[model samples]
Target: MKAARRALPLLAVLLAIGAGACANETHTVPAMPRPDEPVEGFDAHSPGEARIGATPADVMRMLAEDGKPSPTEHALTPEERRKLAAAFGALTPLHRRVLRERLHSISFLDGMPNNALTSPADANEPHRLFHITFRAGILRENLSEFLTQKERQCFDTAGSSRSVSIEAGTMDAIVYVLLHEATHVVDGGLRLTPGSAFTKSAWSDRTLIAPAFRDPLLARVKFRREGEVLPIDRAEAVYAALQRTPFVSLYASSNWSDDLAEAVAWYHLTERLGQPYRIVIRDQGNQVFAYEPMKSPVVRNRFDALSKFYEEPG
Candidate 1:
């Protein structure tokens, strides 16, 4: 018993030192802008962000130009298309190929999407649209609003002006978030492509919207299986997946779909982005990760597994 007691202090010291190293890694990186506060000149709709919302004729028209988009897409208007066309090489051959395949392929009706803001296909037509977004995870919100200014100051005791930092750990997490979010778009059962996609002939003047899904904040996210009840073990696995995502927090585990999407996004970024990234953050002792876009061990294994799944397509 005396020997064990003597060793306990030494073990505690080692643990404390290890944790310190992990915490400092996050504080070492830079900060990013809030999600809603997008940069003015920075365009996210680059080749990587390409989405298909154009009609079949419109898509064919772009194909004639060697896969450049046509002039008449409602969301990506003619001028924007011209400006973004090859701007960042907006529609690379890869993007064009994927866009074309999705447009012509009816296989989408076989799959269902979670976290879709919209449904599939025009109730009036067979055509459909897909939306995509990118994120650099910084999980801090304006806590000052919710907490007293003194409490906020207490949270920021690390003496940083901006609330968060980019760190290696979070960058590892981003690999998951990017993939998960992109999946919500590709999942085919989103808005504009719902179950009625094949039933356009059955359309009536009265459009039906699920009452629960009316608000964006309260939207019902789709999951791997449509309407399947998630057990605690499965739900925990999903959260573990998302906890590995670059931007998730304790709050993310609140729901199953949110957890799944977060995990998927993190897994994708770490693997598919195929670029080196770093991470650095100072949690102000909050225990949150800070990541720079640096290469990471934690992200690599998770991403590799996810990539295999996508490539094999079960």
Candidate 2:
């Protein structure tokens, strides 16, 4: 091992559950390797990055695409139709064409015959689906509104070259939300359950459960593909989706995997600094501390015991 890396302080995390309030737990984390490979096999469907936050026209084209699901047509006010057409009209024929092709080809999607938000249908069936439909400005508005003072502070002080333009904020926020949910999908996909490989363990008030993770990811953070135009987690991909797309609301936040996904995205986005992500820890006393996954890192928090999932390559 390199001496520079050896100089870095290690994070302490518990691999398994122990007694107490679930808060006072401490464990050890082996060093995270620098990810030099792409997560090519990850469940992330690269329907081109355009699906991040699509517009109305993009949405329509997506509806008609090959693997695309037929969206429900709500009775619109004359104003609604106008909004829809304008939103739908915003896309170039090329962009629409691309979206259609991707959605059709994607298999991880969880919707029925006519639902929108077409995800890939791989082993990682989406655990959380967030379809946010609102006026052009609402989603961004809510994000700006939803973030607590601490959240905002964290974003502002983050290390990544990732930028959050208020103007581009809506898609930026939702894309993170999507990635967050996808993280949950990845987490669930790797488990060994009945209908699925991943099953949720019943949460006893005293315990927290973690995902039984799969490879590449089971390694350390890495890029999608070398020389890829953008990282797998990018804000541009989310905002580029046109306005015609349906609005999915907050239910995406309800899942544990979703939160992890968002946290990962946040870390990747602000990953410019050597210190990557800062995960909030929920201790036995039911207290929350924003712990950087670097020095002084404590593994177990409110979510579950995810330390065992960390693997050091042989």
How close to the true structure is residue 303 of candidate 2, measured as C-alpha lDDT?
A: 23
Quality of model 2 by C-alpha lDDT: 0.26
What does candidate 2's lDDT look like per residue over 1-314, in tens digits?
A: 01101111221211111001110112122222222332333333443322324323333343343555544333334643343334323332322332332222211122212111322222122222222222222123223332222122212223443432221122223333333333332333332122221123311111222322212221121111111122323322322221111111111121223323333444333332122333332223342333333222221121233322223335
lDDT of 1 by residue, 40-107 (tens): 33334444434433333322221132334322323444544443333223222323433333322111
* Per-model C-alpha RMSD: 21.6, 20.3
**Model 1 segments more than 4 A misplaced:** 1-119, 123-162, 167-181, 189-265, 274-280, 283-305, 308-314
lDDT of each: 0.26, 0.26
